[model samples]
Target chain A: MKTIWFHLMPYPELPDDFTDEHRSVWVDIDPALFDARVGHRMYNEYIDELEFAASVGFDGVGINEHHSNAYGLMPSPNLIAAALARTCPDAALVVLGDSVALYNPPIRVAEEFAMLDCISGGRLVAGFPVGTPMDTLYAYGNNPATLRERYHEGIELILKAWTADDVFSFNGKYSKLRYVNCWPRPAQKPHPPIWIPGGGSVDTWEWCARVGYSYLYLSYFGYKAALKTMQGFWKCVEDAGRPANPFQAGFAQFFGVADSEAEAIELYREPAEYFFNRCLHVYPGFADPPGYKTLNTVRNGAEGMVERAAREANERAAQAAKKAERKAAQQSFSAASHMSFEQMVEKGYVIVGNPDQVAEKTVEMAKQLRIGHVMSLCHFGNMSRDLAMHNTELMATKVLPQIRHLWDDEWEDEWWPQPLPASDRVMPSPRPTVSR
Target chain B: MIDLAQWKAGSLEIWREGEGRTVGYLHGMVCAPGRQPFVTELASRGFEVVAPSLPGYSRTAPSDDIRNIHDWVFALSEIIDVAGLAGAPMVASSTGAMLALELAAVRPEAFSSLVLVAPLGLWRDDLPVADPFSTTLSGQRALLTKDPTTTALFFEDHESGDALVDATIQRYTARTATASLVWPLPEFGLSQRIHRVSCPVTLVWGSDDQIIDPSYADSFAACLRDVRGRHVVNGAGHLAEWDDPSAVASIAASALN
Candidate 1:
């Protein structure tokens, strides 16, 4: 299995009463709450952590994009990827990735990604995600009804820009460029490997299966909850009659590893609680705009229809039950926020244990799901620089070695980046390692 | 009696009633006009009513061709022509009124006159329009109408035989069309084109409208080339026609005559 270290780079210092007083952590989050001085230090600290993860011999280091959000601070993952490309030469620069539709002309992505691949010497895993509803629809002001359409068109335009030998005049519904040519074409042949980080959209699953791109399910609720979505993707692959190469899939999970289970719990409890509570405290109003969810996702099946019909017959009781149901559904994240650290562990929202235990759980999850890539989120909400280093180093020294050889003997990883030979590469100056 | 029929090769769902002079009706963000009391009242006033559901807002599925405000204006103009309501005095409400004005701005003679009820094509920095798409479903209902009865009758899921799935799809379809037109903000450069509407226009609003404030009646009246007058129906919200059907229909009928 290929283990990639991912960072969300959340703001570490929210007020103690932030959840009590604030309406949301995104979209309409209070601007006054953010301090630029703190952000400056935090950014460098985060970049340092990503470098540290790479230094500890992790196969890859990753970043992603989010807009108008406190957590996942890289609004432009490419900028951070550029920084990593120069310094972390051995580690794959995984940008899990740009929200393609947000760019005007979207060739900006093609240009920028190509530049990163060149700078990193052909080590770039380009992630194309249909952005979260909050980022794309609300913050970026893309119409929900046409967002997916624009996104699909944007991806087509980008892929064509990357590979077309001759300059082409493209007339698309959302964007039209008369002269289309991407300068400084990607270092990797036919562009970097495309990994789609998705949220269980059936259309995305089918598209990934058909296109032979890696489908990465970013698990917020952890591996147990991720079972259905991962199963759904494998089903799509099976139906498409494609090989069930584990490398075709990747899954993200939050991890907290230590010398002992109790130590792991103690170290990770605050950050885990902070992440589930505040970072995920998104306003329900900003979620799932009108056409953000497709009709297939919205419509209840025939059995559900019959059930709904019966429920409609007993209107008052049904309404009362529905109100309760809606409340529970809306509060699902908040419910996680309020959960004790023990509850989060039991639910598998966060995997916390000694190295052997953590490795065992990870291996069990990867094997069960037929996953070749395990994206480890070792640094999360409000975790200090020293503690984060401890988590990453322990995972690297003890945990990764145990799981790294899982799918290697049986399946080849065709999706990973193929960097140029080290002898031919331009090297940066080696910095003295920081002692924690 | 109102009849439901399909137009444009079964791609448009239209409601038609009465048998005299044609009065083209355009519906707002929520329900189709097939069973609205205002459409019934307008028909009883001795004029033919042709109400075509805006694409994706009713039984008609969303068309890929109609993607933006410009396409919407073109589509509405086509509907007006195909429904045989060209040069007829038009009655439009909310999101439909927004499209009606956009069409009139460019086509001019598309409608003989227009009685627009709380249209949502203008924005003010100080009094920004309340966004229905950015709020909860209950919050959207509250913004649409002031009366709980109207909310229950139209917005709530209380009908006996209707499947919840169908109702949910209906609501989502309506929202998709409406959001496509007016989401983020309703302003689609209508302020720049409002002066080009050659036909006379009568603006009406609910006194208690929250979506686009009733005060915006002045904003529209100020820019329109030929404004007959502006009327505010008391004890109503954005969907004034639903709250006080007789008052809204009477105002619309009087304006058209």
Candidate 2:
């Protein structure tokens, strides 16, 4: 199993009364609340953390994009990826990733990803996300009805730009280009390993399966809640007649480990609360826009194909009752914002224990979910640098070694990044001292 | 209630009744044209009311070609011509009023006269239009009218009990159509083109309109080429026709006459 240290890089200085006073944490989040000097310090500290994670034997280091958001400071993950490509020499540069539909032409993504792959010596895992409603529809003002269409077209355009041998002319509904040629081709022959980080959209699952891309379920809710979505994805993979390779899927989980169970809880409780309560306190209005979810999703149960199939198994009279229960279960993540820490623990929102125990539980959950990759968010919310480092060091030194040998012998891990050896890697010459 | 009338662009569910001169009606942001009480009131007031549910507002499938405001204007103009109410006196409301004015600006003789209620074609940075799409359904109901109860026609389950999904899709398609034209902000440069409308326009506003301020009436009046009159009905909100259909019908009848 491969582990990636993922950071949301949230602002740490929101006042105690932020959730009460502000209407939302995104889109129309107050500009006055963000302090530039603090941001400058946070950016440097966050990058240092990612670099530290890479040095400590983590397989990959990751960052993501979010716009007009207080929780995620990264509006451009590519900039962070560029910085990491030079600094984190031993780690995969995972940008999980750019919202392709948000770009005007979307060739911007192809060019940038190719550039990152080249700079990182082919250790790049490209992530394409359709994006949240707040980021895509409200903040960027993309049409909700047409966002998915643009995303589909944008991916098509980007793939052709990367793989096509000759320059081509492209005509599309959302974008048109007279000349379509990417200057710096990716170091990876076909393209970088494509990972789609998605929410529970049925169409997204089927698309990822059909195209042979690894599906990364980036959910805040823990493995228990994620089981349903991952099950639906595996069903799609089965229906597509593809090999049920564990490496074809990835799951993100927030974990806290220490010397003892009590110590782990004490250390992680505040940051966990901060993340669930304050960071996730988005306005309900920004959650779902008209046409954001497809008509098919609306017609089927909100949980998508799995729920529909489950409903069909039950007697017709009992389906409605089961649906009402499912609806409450879906709200469990948002309800975490108001829940007690013990409640969160019992419900599996965050996995907390000693290093050995955490390792044991993680392996168990990974096997049950049939996934090989874990994007571990060890540092979350307003967790301090010292605490974050301790957590990372513990997870790297003790936990990772225990889980490392899980699927290595049974199946080939094909989705991991393949970096060029140091002998073949290119390094720019140092700048010469200027003479007067 | 008449079945949907087919046109070149798509099928439109229309409300057509009564006899005498034709009076075309276009609905506001809340519901389709026929769903509102004013359509029936106007039809009963001794005139033929030709009110077609704009494309995507009813069961008719939205065309992929209709992507922007220009396409909306062209499609709406074509609907009026196909429905055979091209030269009739028209009464339009809110979002419909915005489209009607756009059509009138480009094709002067499309309507003999126009009665526009709380049209949404202008923007004031300080007095911004309340975003109907960004709030809860109940909150949106409160913005659309002074009394939230009047919005049951929009939120209440349809008569077909098992067709809940179908009703949700209807509302979503209607919202998609409106948001395509008015989202982020409702202004689409109609202030610059208001001078081109040759037909006489009578403006109406709900005194308590929260979506677009009642004061915006003066803003529209200042730019229009020919403003016959401006009237504000008392005890009403943004969808004034829903609040007091009799008063809106009476005002519209007087304007048409």
**Model 1 chain A lowest lDDT segment of ten:** A301-310
Please compute DockQ, using alpha carbons, for every candidate against the native two-chain complex.
0.74, 0.50
lDDT for B138 (candidate 2): 75
Error of 2 at A95 (Å): 1.1
Looking at candidate 2, what is the lDDT of residue B61? 60
Q: Per-residue lDDT of A275-362 in model 1, one digit per residue for the tens? A: 8766766665667578877777666221111122222223423454566577765533323235567877998978999999999999
Give the range of the ten consecutive residues with the poorest summed lDDT in model 2 chain A.
Answer: A304-313
**Looking at the true structure's interface, with contacts defined as alpha carbon pairs within 8 Å between chains A and B, what fraction does model 2 recover?**
0.49
Looking at model 1 chain B, report the run of 10 residues with the lowest lDDT sum.
Answer: B1-10
Using all chains and alpha carbons, the TM-scores for the candidates as numbered come to 0.92, 0.92
RMSD (Å) per prediction: 5.3, 5.7
TM-score of chain A of each: 0.90, 0.90
DockQ, candidate 1, comes to: 0.74
